[model samples]
Target chain A: MKLRFRDSMNWLHTWSCVVLGCLLFAVFLTGTLAYFQYEITHWMQPEVEQIQHKDKAINQAQAYLNTHTENAPRWTIVPPNERFSPIVAYWRDKNTTGRFSVARLDEQGNEINSRATRGGEFLYRFHFDLHYMPVFYARWLVGIAAMLMLVGIITGIVVHKKIFKDFFTLQFNKGAKSWLNSHTVCSVLALPFHIMITYTGIVTLMLMYFSWAMNMGDGDRRSFFSAFSDQAPALKASGEKAQLLPLGDIYNSAKAQLGHAGIGSIIVSNPGDSNAMVEVYENATEELTSDYRTLRYHGVTGELLHDSGVTNAAEQTRRTMISLHAGRFADTSLRWLYFLSGIMGTAMVGTGLLLWSNKRKQKMNPRFRIGYKIMDVTNLASIIGLPLAISGYFAANRLLPLQLESRAEWEIHCFFIVWLMAFVYPILRGCKHSWQELSFITGVSYLALPVISIFTTSRHILNYQFERDATLLFMDLLLFFTGGLFIYIAYIVWRKGYEPAVIARPKRPPRGVVQ
Target chain B: MTIKAFLQAISNAKGMQILWRVVLASVLGFIFLSVFIAGVASLGSALFHLSKATLMLWLMLIGIVLYCCLVMWIFASNKLMRCSVIIIAGIVISSAALYAGDMLHKNHQPVESR
Candidate 1:
């Protein structure tokens, strides 16, 4: 038996996708949404209004920090940005663990207690960290999935003979042929985005994948990272007490130096020590590159010390790739492109999964093989179930008692619990009914999100507060459109019905059988 | 070739051969990538004036690209035994290059300093 390269690629592409398609779907969906994570966070925490003044917020945050922990070893101040997060101040006391305590400030320069939801942060971490698993193992698993996706994408390109020409062809209702067309169209629509996202996603975790890269260095990771990355070298306190010069002075000097670029964050190391150093990082919005400009100053005197940034072309290329993946520099319009491309990637994976089952159903005798059942269930659960589970997460954020223990963790719990229900529903009710029912339920649930907000919070869609800010209105419109799409899909699935695409072929005599 | 022609050739693969290829590409391909990175770094030290960090990073980027291609080649090649031999030969040759390159760099460094 002999196989050519293209034939082998087809087999590799199919099986690789079959094995890892569900995981890839989840990652692509979540990661794509994370492009709007800041917007999502704004929606989840509706009470926090936009800041009218950036510099004033910084001064207020510093004053508040002075009142709270005067002699704290370190303090970080992040000014309010277009992302809608308030002025945030982070600090760590000597007695506390290494974790910094976060405080949110409103326009009035006073600390405000918003509802206790992880907000967009949970989605951001979930894309890579995952849940119900340790971060170490989860990262490894996600990394492996990313690598296989790269394989699938490359092999997929090789296997499709009319890959480019198929961009013009579509047969809407031909069952298996339609599924193939759907997969091909989605794949072709955003081929570059899929390839770039997969490759850059892997680069984000490449250090972990190639941990042996550490040995090539001269055993000094701190200096190596500082040299190649944007971090300043680590500093320790002198233990001699000294007052920090007003942050406003340092901000003014850095502002003059930075010109048009706004300061994104200010970190002061050893605030009360003689050797205190203040680090100011330039905002990411000024450039598409993730390697932002940095200015370090003497904490007491407010003199500019040094600027830390990418040293050479190699590091710059690496940093740019990561920045492209994160999309942190994306403005409103570019973010929409990212979101739409993400939707395309998710649809590609979804249709690929469905296409697998459809192809098998056509070839095999229609019976209850565990493999078929599992495939059909996964296809239904993942494509339809994920949106429903995400809605459950949002619902939990609104409904859970604010004072409940570990309320944030409970929100994530709601997400997984709903997801598990989605997985189980198909097995009990059978895939045919389950697909339509779950999609319909998911659609209504999403449509009901705005209604739920009306009852649970002060800033629902019907309320007058939306007139003050359009973020919630934007979110509500998005939810309604998504709900409408899901409903349309359910209708289509109901009309077409889930009958097996059984192609009746005449059987040939058994080859080389001894009669 | 058409899709039909390409798919007909898929019937040529055996179950055992598929399993062997998976292991050889994933596990052994990674080993080759690691050694290849070290080999490039060592060889780069004598040739380029770049810092170790920059050298390692660029070599890693190159190594991963090569590894992705190698994995594809491992499956596509009809000669499965030959693919294994090539991977093994890669490991051995890269390891030797690393050793010899390191020695050359060490010998070359002092004279330049003087």
Candidate 2:
């Protein structure tokens, strides 16, 4: 029963990956999609495609906020960036103590009646928060899975002694070997990225995951956060009313101070109060480190109050690590690399799942083993089903009535429903039949997205020339590209047949060892 | 081997041993590793006069890699007993160091009322 160190590692890597692979796959897929979330959100909300001027949009937002949110305690203006087409604005009234109320504005600062959809924010949130569950539970579950993934990655490296030698060893149509090669290549090629991502992912929620560590310090979590970001405590709003300085002037001053650094957002706190503070936050995307350079000004007098930048080396290191993990600082090309790397991570998990089932299938009499059947169904559902569900989400976005109540909720419901169906279908119809059928369905659904968009909204690939919005055109092309990949995969699955043509079963070990 | 056989194996003594080893490697090993990192970080903070938050973050960043190494060692060890001994020893040593660091920190600070 005694295993060599390498053999034990092999065992660990296999079991850990199999146990957490499906969730890991979902996480990786959604996280990858989140990289382009803003772009996808823009594509989804086609009504705002006409607003092109970013500076003019901010002015419009100011005018709109002045009239609408005069009595509000706080107002934030998120100027349109490369990904988001709309001038997004939010205000929190003194009466409502909860989250701010959001409004989408156009070039003229008038509210746009956009279609009700969660857009890319859903995918972005779902990446970590997940669906049909409380965020607290979801994050914990995801954190555990990420930790296991880190374990798997390390053990996998140990198990594969010939990692470098096998780096270029890819044999197509070799069945299990092919899958193993793919898994290996994906993991090895992006090994540094995989490590960075897994470690940083854990770090992103470190406060929650290791709350005990924070408790070891000063008990107040707020103080820890304030110390972490190096921000001073905000002064309370004075009751006396005052005439606020023009936002345009404050923006100009902030722009001058930052000197070419893009302003990510403008926060006006305690609006209409004498002690109102207007803070402009610099876009972190311009540099590798996620610098939170802020210039706080007196909201009324336009006088500069405080400017804080990262000064401490330790804090800078921490922020840099976080920024690297988020990839917010990455330009378009670097973002694509991050996306591709994320896709590789996802594929590695997928192949690992398949490898587990494939290795077992080769040795066992497939029909007799209920375990094999379960594995088969799970692999099919998670690997192909989630994508199918995502396609369903997009389709629902297009098909749903514009004025339908809870339209965003319905889109999410449709996603889960389709995903649930995928999970159940394999169990009922048999894994082989379900895999082929669902794969085709997924392929068709994705391919049909462009046509659906053309019918549902004015924003289509055809209308890209009129709007001069490359983001819209690029999104359409990407969808088609993904659809093509799925269709090709479906075609391969159909052509190759359901069951493996040859089963190269490994010999059973002695009674002491399970493998 | 069939599914029945595999299930039977899992219920048997040898399977239980393997299961315990996995637990040791993943769970106890992680705890031991975190404790060790905390102790080291506390000491580092005191020595360098770094803020507790900064040192904690630095330790956490390093802990990821350190934990992986510990896991590898846990699995690679020739005996489960050896792995257990290592983790227990780590916990004991780190706890003492952490306590010492806390005492030193308290002693260095001037008494202040809330």
Which candidate number maximizes DockQ? 1
Per-residue lDDT over A1-515 for candidate 1, one digit per residue giving the tens place of the 0 to 100 score: 27788988898899878787888899989998898887788888887788877766777777788789846778999877776778788998878776688888887678876687778878889989998889999998888888888889999999987988876867788867888898999999999999999888988888777766445432445655655665556567888888888777788788788886757899989887888999998865656664467899988777777887656888777777887888877878898999999999999999999888887886765444666778888888888999899989988988899778888889999999999999999999988788889999999888888888899888777775545657788988899998888888889889988684444555567999765
Please give the clash total of every predicted structure, in order. 0, 0
Residue A417 displacement (Å), model 1:
0.7
Q: What DockQ results for candidate 2? A: 0.34
Model 1: colliding residue pairs: none
Interface RMSDs of the predictions, in order, are: 2.6, 2.7
Clashing pairs in 2: none
Per-model C-alpha lDDT, please?
0.81, 0.81
Give the range where candidate 1 chain A is weakest over 10 consecutive residues by summed lDDT: A213-222
The lDDT leader among the candidates is 1
Q: Model 2 off-target regions past 4 Å?
A: A66-71, A365-368, A500-515, B1-12
What does the lDDT come to for candidate 2?
A: 0.81
Candidate 2 CAPRI assessment class? acceptable
Residue A363's C-alpha lDDT in candidate 1?
71
